[model samples]
Target chain A: QKEVEQDPGPLSVPEGAIVSLNCTYSNSAFQYFMWYRQYSRKGPELLMYTYSSGNKEDGRFTAQVDKSSKYISLFIRDSQPSDSATYLCAMSAVTGGSYIPTFGRGTSLIVHP
Target chain B: DAGITQSPRHKVTETGTPVTLRCHQTENHRYMYWYRQDPGHGLRLIHYSYGVKDTDKGEVSDGYSVSRSKTEDFLLTLESATSSQTSVYFCAISELLAGGFHEQFFGPGTRLTVL
Candidate 1:
């Protein structure tokens, strides 16, 4: 099994709909969890970041992490068409004196207008 | 785009040719990383540097090499590029925050196609 698992979803949703994207991992040592958004032909940009387990809210975006279940999620409330992009989940631990994140294959989201 | 820039944003080269991609950062972050993105596979780390002249191999370091002679520049070289090496490459810089947490910012990415 891969260290991280995320559905490669072309998840289509109507405008103003709420969107939920999730990823699961097996590493219990992963203390830092992050979400990144990438547009077509562009590099991934940091969207949300959370440490350990808890929820962090930023405007319309919320990031949740569950260390016990090894699950993480990103919730987009009242999504807009401009929110269409690939969402990637990454987690890292301080290994070998460095923190290198392991990424899951991104989920493609399309908020149609 | 946190003061990070990657050169040769697009390139096409024949197999067995040598190629070099450069990542330049102005943020002066102590951590720099190289990653490749491809279909079915997410971003895979190729290499990373913690300080000048300090570099280490990543998961997919085979068939690739890197050099960091200066703090602002980190270069990845494919001594003999292959079709399998063709992919979008990204350079990232990390800013260490309080409590030992770090955030990474990526550059615009370089697309390389080998035929």
Candidate 2:
């Protein structure tokens, strides 16, 4: 499939724990859902942004969208160590007029201290 | 970051020579993008622009080539470089606020190395 399915996680929590990241999609007009945060070499940064489905908080980060199970999530409640890095999941759907973004193959967070 | 700025953050060419990567923006967003981050393929969109001689062609636009005359500039060209076109190159800017909420703001990457 691979319209967008993230799980390239190196996931290794410990700081404050409670970190969960996921993504699953097959199109269906992906209405927009993003969460990016890359650090190693730097570049992707926009942490959490939702439009379709519900759930969106911006403190410890929490963005969840479930457009009828297309699924999308990013929660990192108490994590620390500056919240490691690499966690990307982007989606877009405007077609003709323009709006292109479909990326997923990231999820490598390691907040350990 | 947001205001974007990428230019020879680091480069090391060789493959076939000819490489130009520059994306500068001072906001004035009207949509302008060109991404490429390999290692398993995460961010991939090779060109975009919606004004100033408008442009298009993404999804790994074969070998790459883009140029937006003005509008804060956006140019990515690798006429002959290979080595799978090295990686790390991002430049984004979006604006369509209100309801449609399209927000993309990046640029602090450009680490080419085709040898």
Please tell me which predicted candidate would have the highest TM-score against the true structure.
1
Q: Write the per-residue lDDT of candidate 1 for residues A1-113, one digit (tens) a residue.
A: 99999999899999999999999999898999999999999889989899889999999999999998999999999999999999999999966587689999999999999
Residue B73 error for model 2, in Å?
A: 14
lDDT for model 2, please. 0.87
TM-score of each: 0.97, 0.34
Measured with DockQ on alpha carbons, how good is candidate 2? 0.32
Task: DockQ each candidate and list the results.
Answer: 0.83, 0.32
**Winner by lDDT:** 1
| Candidate 1 chain B: worst-modelled 10 consecutive residues by lDDT | B94-103
Please give, for residues A1-113, the per-residue lDDT of candidate 2 as tens digits: 78998988689989998898999998989888999898898888778789889999999989989889999999989899988999999999865587777889798898889
Mark the regions of model 2 whose C-alpha exceeds 4 Å error after superposition.
A1-13, A17-36, A39-45, A48-59, A62-76, A80-83, A86-109, B1-16, B19-29, B34-50, B54-75, B79-87, B91-93, B99-102, B105-112
CAPRI class of candidate 2: acceptable
Clashing pairs in 1: none
